[model samples]
Structures are given as C-alpha cells and as structure tokens.
Target: MRNKGPKIIILTASYGNGHLQVANSLYQECIRRGYDNVKICNLYTESHPFISEVTEKLYSKSFTYGKQFYKLFYYGTDFIQNKKMLRWYYQYGFKRLTSLIETEEPDILINTFPINAVPEFRRRTGIVIPTFNIITDYCLHSLWLHDDIDKYYVASNELKAKIHSRGVTESKVVVSGIPIRPSFSQSLDKSMLFDKYQISPKKDLILLIAGAHGVLKNIKETCETLLLKTDHQLAVVCGKNHSLRNEMAQLENKYRDRLHCFGYLERIDELYRIASVMVTKPGGITLTEATATGTPLILYMPVPGQEKENARFFSEKGAALTAKNQEELLNSIDSLLKSKQKQLSLQLSIKKLYLPSSQEMIMTDILKESEKISRMKNHSTIKSQKKKLGS
Candidate 1:
C-alpha cells in the first residue's frame, strides 16, 4: 500500500556494506527532519532475486578463494568497448523497479550505489520528480557515469574532479562527503567510550577490523607480534567471521587484559571513538568513519584495485600510515605508539580530512530540490486553471 505521506525510497546493495551505510545515514537524517514517509530497501533483493543469489555466491567465492578475483572483476571493466551492457541493464533492471516508484509516487529518489544509479536514471523518463546519486566511494566507477543522472553527491573534491574527467557535467557534481552515521557528527566523551568498552585510558588502544569477510591472511600473525613485542593493547573486530572470532577469542584468553575480541558489533562508533589507532584496509566508508571519529589509521593488506588506490590517497594526505608486511606493520605501530608528537600530528591530519556534516548537506540538497519541483508544479497547475476559466 502507498504511504499516506510523501515518500522517498532509498535503494542500496549489500556487496561491501558501504552503500548500505550511506543509505541508512540518509534515512535517519530525513526522518529526523520530519520526513517520516522515507523507506529503505535492498535493490538486489527487491528487483533481481536471481541475480542477487548469484552475486552472493560470487562474493563468497572471492572471500574464500582469494579477493584477487573480485579485484579482477573491478579491473575487468576496462574491457567494455561501449555502453551496450549499460543500456541493457537500464531497460531490464529499471523496469523491475518501476512498480515501487509508481505505487509510492515519491517526491524524491536517492541512489546510494552506482550499480543502481544508471538504471534509475533510465527509468526516470517523463517523471517530474528529482533524483540524486550519493556516491559512497572515493573513486568514480563506470556504472556511476551517465548523462541522465541529475546530481552526483561525491566524497571529496578529488573525486568530484575525477567524475568530471569521466565526461560528466561539472555542474552536476557536488563535493559533499559520503554520509556517515549521525552519532559521528556529535561529540562523544572518549573516556566514556573507553569505559564502556572496559578499556584502560592510560594505555594506547588499537582497533583492528577485518574486512566484511574477515582478516587478511597475515592479520592474525600481525596481531600476535604487536601484542608480544609492543605495549599497545589491541581490540580485534572480526565482523561476521565466526571462525576468526573464535580463534581471536582463544588468543585473547591468553593475553587477558591486553586483547579484546568482538564479532558483528553494533556500537562500532564507540570502538572508533575510544581507539588511539586503527588497523584495517582502506575501504572508503571505514576510512571516512575513522576520520569522523579522529582515529589514526594503519592500513594493511589493501587489495590491489580500488582499495590500493584508496590507501595511497589516504597515506599521501598523512591521515594514515601504510605497512608493506608484518615487520613493517610492527614498526609502523611501534613508531606511532612511541611518539606523542606523531600521534598528535596524525590526529591533526585526520581533522583536516573530516567532513562531519555530510549527512546534513546531502539531505538538505534533496529537500531543496524537492521544494523547487513542488513550486514548479503548483505554478503550472495555476496556469492550467486560469486558461480553463478563460476558455
């Protein structure tokens, strides 16, 4: 059934979780602003059940066999000779999603994932409503470049420039950072965060997150070396990796007070809030969140395609330090821990990278556009009524 109030349907995908994170942030901000008719849905689940199932199998394969396969798929985009596949997906995929839009007749539509953006644009023909694409990554992708897309909400000026380089109109891109959880914009008591996690504020705390599927091959060995060779306490978050969580729990028992292990945690913002340093791959969303919380980054084992590029961009800007292997990872961690000056410098760099109010910025843009459309419709209706009375 259609909602009685105005609706804005947010579409996201589950491949890496960044898109979903961006979508959720927009949802919360809209509701806070009294747009209670907003709804969130998984794009693949709703429109393409068979394709979603296949994508899940492919994701598991990449996670288990090797992430290089996923990298290969991302890199394989270079081979596309033209926009043939893009046009096909626009027709088939967008057709499947039209019913929801027709049923709700939303005032605005938001696309948080690139895979969903092109199709959305194609489906929007003859519709007067506004559409916006909130890109959740630092880099632009082929799937994100389309003339029909009205606005592009980007993470950084660098990405905005890159999107323009891909032949998009400069007027269409907005360099608003990726939307993050609203809690990130609020100031939190660091000590309270530490207390909540039962971590000591006196010692430097490190947060280690395995990517969605789990740790890099050398992460376990790296964790052991840090705990044994250095004084910094480590908290490892193995998200959705039951086996890795169990293994880390066994190790934590031996280390006692120094090591903490967690799985599928809800309060990740708290972890970032309390941590002095963070060790993880440079996923766009994770890095953005870490910056929001002012946590220093030690990026390790970045995958070879987009992640590698993300790591380079971060380290060059001094927001993070990169490690080539176990020895280097240990050395980098030790160096950061040993120097109070270095830690302070890193914190200052993180502050420079912060875009704390992106959720507000993106949502505000959407509302302004919707209001403009509403005013235009009202003016057009009055014109028609006047003409009918004169006739």
Candidate 2:
C-alpha cells in the first residue's frame, strides 16, 4: 500500500522560503498518504547552484536595502514579452533541470517556484509528464503561467479568475488555498500550550514573528510599544536570527515575566494556538499558516511587490490588518486587543480563507491527472503497435 501511489518530484527554489515551504507541505502530505517515492528537489541549488547562491544574496540584499529595485525587477519580468528574454537567460537552468528530470523519470512533476520547468523540459526532451504549478502567492504572476501545465492550484477565486483571463482554461485552475503544514490545522489545547511556554493563561498573548530571515525593521521599538501600550504578554519568535534573539533577551529583565524570546522552535503551531494575535511580515507561507490557525495578523511593513499584494488580499478579506508604520502597528494591535468583536470577526474571516484540507485535495487532483495521463500514453502506445502489426 505504501508503494502504490505515483512517483512524485516536487521542484522548488530558495528565492524565498514560501516556495520551499509549500513544496514541503505537499511532500509531507504525499508521504502521509503513503506515497513511497515522493522526492523534493531544490531546483536552484541542485541544478543551478551558483545562480541560486547569487540570486539568493541579491534577493536578501534587495529586500534589506533596495526594495524599490526589487520591485522594479519583479514587475519588469512580469510581462509576456519580457519573459522571452528571461527564458533565454535561464536556458542553462532549463537544460540542467531537464537532465535531472531525465534522470529521475518521475510520474508527475510539481513546481512551487515561479519557473515553468515542466514546459521547458517538454520543449527540450519531448517528454509529456503530468505537471502542477502551485502558485504560492495570493496573486498570479505571468512567470507562473505555462501552457503545458495540466493544473494550477491558486490561493483564491479572484486569482483563478485572473488566470482564466490570461487565457488559461478555467478547468485547469483549482482554487485551493496555499497548502500549509498539516500541524497548523490541528487543534492544540490552550492550557497545555500556555503551560509549555510558561505564560500566564489569565493574560492575552501577543506573538511577534520577525520572519525566517529576521528582517523586521525596528523590532526593538515595536516590542517596546507592545509592552508599554498593551496589557498582553509578548512572545517573540526571531527565526534563525540569533542576534535579534539576544537583543530581545535584554527586555526580559525590564519587562519581567511578560517577555518571551525564542530563536527557532519547530512546534510553532503550539505558539500560534496560544497567542490571541500575531504581528509579522506578510510572507505567503507564514500568512497561510496563521490563517490555518485562525490567528488574526497585524502585517507590519510588507515588502514592495508580492508581500504587498498578499497583505492587500488578506486585508480586503478581513483576515488581517496592515500596518505601514510604528504608529499604525501600535494602533492596530491595541484595537485588536481591546475589541473582542473585531478579533472574532478576523478569526472567522481567516477560517473562511484557510482550507484545512488543501493538501488532500491537491494530492487527489494530482493522482487523478497522473492516471489520466498514464491511460492516454498506454492507448497511444497500443495504437502504434497495432498500426505497425497491420502494416
């Protein structure tokens, strides 16, 4: 039973953690469903190492220092005409990826990254594999569109309509919210989590996430504002940012037992469950996970391009509130903390947006598509053999 499902290869890049996170979610789902030969590949690092390294550095630098430049680059390649040049530049990656695909010979290919590797692979090797493109962001980018893809999993109906408007058939698009790790959708006992984190169950909890790279600007000021302005206890998760963790540690003494700072914890679901509200950047994966947990979010200074779009989508959906500056951040947090009605409204909105069974739906669709493709291939092969025999 474990080895019964099709061989799956999920291709993702490290331009941001969102893509890889989505890929990993799908990989985990496949394994959970007893798919034995599921493989996750980091396309950029495995197939194009030097390019991935340089682009990752540039990506970090752009977000940290040159956001305007990053936005410019994001929009520049978003046009169909510009995509030709972009594809030409990535010909080397295409070839390397095609070689890797030839070696693996997967039954299906799932791409969480922007690059349409499946189409390029078919163009080069003439192999037609069932392909799925899981768009990690709320909005659709032209780079994620590919004629050869059999299915597209989008975050919303608006995104599905947008893709349909771009000439992709409506049947090919599925409005499945971005798949998050299954743990986020699970129910955790609040008292247990409170005891585990050593926080008082009597007080409301505020969770602050500085993101995976720890790039939250003015985190100290934000923390101070939360402490001074609100009555709730603060839990700050500085993911992979040791320096930020160390800096946050000093506040423990001044604030006494109200402050909790952690570097990285695998069981983030527990924290999400205990916290009444979350303050973080609007990354696709983080937002999806928060929504899964029905935690209202205060999106702080999302980057110019995709993050802004994600923030806008969630804000419009009533799932989150956007805070562009410290004043807005403080005000938004204060408002949410004081108003139970607003908090409940946000929680309900998030519940509507979050698809708890997205992983299962995605896996079912992929398997169905793979079976269709396999049948077609077998039929074609049979026809060819019969024709040869008759001739």
State each model's CA lDDT, in order. 0.78, 0.84
TM-score of each: 0.89, 0.94
- How many collisions per candidate? 0, 0
* Model 1 alpha-carbon drift over 4 Å, by segment: 1-5, 60-64, 78-81, 116-125, 373-391
- Positional deviation of 130 in candidate 1, in angstroms? 1.5
Global local distance difference test of model 1: 0.78
Residue 369, candidate 2: alpha-carbon lDDT = 82
lDDT tens digits by residue: candidate 2, 253-278: 78978988888778888898888899
Residue 202 displacement (Å), model 2:
2.2
Clashing pairs in 2: none
**Candidate 2 Cα lDDT to native:** 0.84
